[model samples]
Target: MTTKTEKVEASTKIRPRIGRWEVDDHNEVALLGTRCAACGEVAFPEHQICVNCGSESTEVVRIKGPATLRNYTIVHQLPPGYERPWVVGYGEFDGQLSVLAPIVAASRDELHEGLSLSLCVGVTKVDDDGEEMYSYQFTPTKA
Candidate 1:
């Protein structure tokens, strides 16, 4: 019989596409950021030094809540190795942290400025080693 830990490990074989995010045992995705201890400023992707006060006192923090879509655009021309077009947008969380990521939607008409977005993890690409890679993206929250 398989153990619980083994089952979880086997099910979570997909690796993160980047170092800025992580997937938990429940498959929940959270973006890592840095919060300045001195100035209370938050920066995405985490930072070693605070951009506001130039202090090295910073701690890693998880970004939460639905982000507000500030702006977006559809890209028709993609770089080599990419087959389909995609939508990218700038979203702000808590009115403080802003992140630029791919927007997953059924159609371009579904997207609009000031729309609420939730963070989620999805398969992005397969590495040369044939392993699936996952990345964080923003999806429109259900009405």
Candidate 2:
């Protein structure tokens, strides 16, 4: 005899804070970026024009994780509606484009330049409407 498996559907469908990042049908999160057809340079937030060569031939592309931590710092003072004392840093992806995002680490000792980081999405803050705002962050790679 075999046991039957049951499928549970999500009660509520979640959406991203910004449409740039989205969870695909496979439940995989991907950051949307723009690539210049002329110079082959990529830009985040899906640029309409290429910032490098000023080319209008920009195409939207999916940028996947495994970025390197170039630099980071702990922010003591935070803006309104933000959780204070958060770590912010820049992660270099595709060996060219560096994206600034929150860094999630257990301790500062686990953070350093050239450290491997994987992109992840999580709730950054709650809006006045009580909606959960999501943002991308870089977490330490697991060995």
Candidate 3:
């Protein structure tokens, strides 16, 4: 089966929304996080200050996959430069951090809280310049 990163690499003009993620040599996408040396808090998007302990010293770390979906809602309306009728939800990873991300599913009925989900690299939208904005989204795990 084709992986998410392989789909991303197939795109002609794929660009990440932020610099916090990248596709590795194996075509697996990984997210960069900041782990505080003082409190061992891991913060996504690699923040300078630790959200848990407010520590200024932190190092970049890779976040693993297989997060659990806590909750979600179908968005009928979309923001500027985005598509319509998408799912957004919060995913809890490692029991320490809960992150809000786009929930990608075959249908809205397939989404629910406490569902097992995993990170997938996908195109959120195509900009006016025709660049595909690659970002992370949570998808229901296959049984």
Ranking by lDDT: 3, 2, 1
Model 1 segments more than 4 A misplaced: 1-19, 24-27, 125-132
Highest-scoring model, TM-score: 2
Task: Tell me the tens digit of each residue's lDDT in model 1 across 4-74.
Answer: 22333566556433437666666556788889999999988778999779899999988875899999988
TM-score of 3: 0.78
Comparison by lDDT, 1 against 2, better one: 2
What are the models' TM-scores?
Answer: 0.76, 0.79, 0.78
lDDT of 2 at 121: 73
lDDT top scorer: 3
Query: Which residue pairs clash within candidate 1?
Result: none
Candidate 1 lDDT (Cα, whole model)? 0.74
- Expressed as tens digits, the lDDT of each residue in 1-96 for candidate 3 is 233445556667644534366656665556778899999998887888998899899999877677888888888887566777878888898796
- Clashing residue pairs, backbone N/CA/C < 3 A, model 3: none
Please list the Cα RMSD from the true structure of every candidate, rounded to 1 decimal place: 5.7, 7.6, 5.0
The TM-score obtained by model 1 is 0.76
Model 2 CA deviation exceeding 4 Å by range: 1-19, 24-27
